[model samples]
Target: MAANKAKRPLPSAQPMRHNPNPQQILRPQYGLRISPAGSQPQRSRLHARETAQLMPVKAHVYRTIAELNGGFEKVIQDLQTLRQISFFRNDRVTAMHDLICRVRAQANRDFTMTLHGRELANAGHFDGLCIEWEKQIEDRSDT
Candidate 1:
């Protein structure tokens, strides 16, 4: 019975597969970093600050220019640009309107100043003419 027993083959061992290219190995490279889960992502704070600083001007600068230069044309152009930005909303539009009002006020002040200047010039010219007429009359009466 021992001589008749069948021999069994042992299980074959298989070799582990690995990448042959060294570059395929996962390792930290220059300018690259791994962040832990729930940690803040790497970002440029200066760039963010600059973008934050620019957004307000990009959003509102045209209206400010219009106010200082006294024109709704600039405000209209600003609205056109503002419409293209997804983030600008009703608040910005309302601010633009307020700026338009301010521009109108500035224009009114400029017009008033011009009118007053012209009126003063006319009054001065009239006074000069009166003085000349009085001098001519005094000379005629003395002769």
Candidate 2:
């Protein structure tokens, strides 16, 4: 039979005060602790089918992207990457490839939108000029 005992009386219990400035606490307590239980909240017990896929985007990478695009493009870019990775549910490397594709897709879409918009503006100007030219021809024929 296995036996277990409290190691050291579990320390004297102290009444927890409402920490006014939680930031002042030496070790900030969180709603969830990041321990060996894995960095995520315990969900329905992991069956063989459910695998842990913890992908944390790093701060430096965030900073780098913010610098590149003045922060305007980071969130959507990251979300697109997340969606791409989600496609390869069981394969990590393939998911990473999907991440690259998402980024490339974002870049391609950005450029395509810019070109499409410029083309539309130019088309509008050309269309207006064509109308103006037709009116000028009618006026000249009347003269």
Candidate 3:
């Protein structure tokens, strides 16, 4: 009876699991290449093609931001001029209020555009524009 119960072979040991390296997916021509040493995260990893692609984007973003900021400045100056005019005359309150409303609307639009620009690549330097706009409107009671 003992001999009939035949010995069973032991199970083989499990194999070790393999760890796979992360796969790098490159864009058609706009992705940055990783540096071998990885010393600087921002300055070192930029590829030549990606840098060229970013130049035009950076220029356009800066130009747009500058123009919008200039427009805001002009509108604020105009409002200031209007305030000075109203100081000498009480009859222009209604007109001044209407002009203020218009200027406020334009400023709102500029703020929205600045936010949209932030979504674009390399256009994150919009804080200056936002701060300038806010500073101009800070003293005004109409805003």
lDDT of each: 0.56, 0.51, 0.52
lDDT of 1 at 28: 32
Where is the poorest 10-residue window by lDDT in model 2? Answer: 47-56
- At residue 22, candidate 2 shows an lDDT of 56
**Highest lDDT model number:** 1
Instruction: Compute the lDDT for candidate 1.
Output: 0.56
Query: Per-residue lDDT for 94-138 in model 2, tens only?
Result: 565566667767866775576566656656656666887899999
Query: What TM-score, to 2 decimals, does candidate 1 have?
Result: 0.33
Error of 2 at 121 (Å): 0.6
Give the clash count for each candidate. Answer: 0, 0, 0
lDDT of 3 by residue, 1-143 (tens): 13333233323333346764445332233344455575532333445534533322334444555565566555565655666674555446547656766876787688557655544534433444467678889868466
Q: What's model 1's lDDT at 74?
A: 55
Instruction: Decide which is better by TM-score, 1 or 3.
Output: 1
Q: How many clashes in candidate 1?
A: 0
Best by TM-score: 2
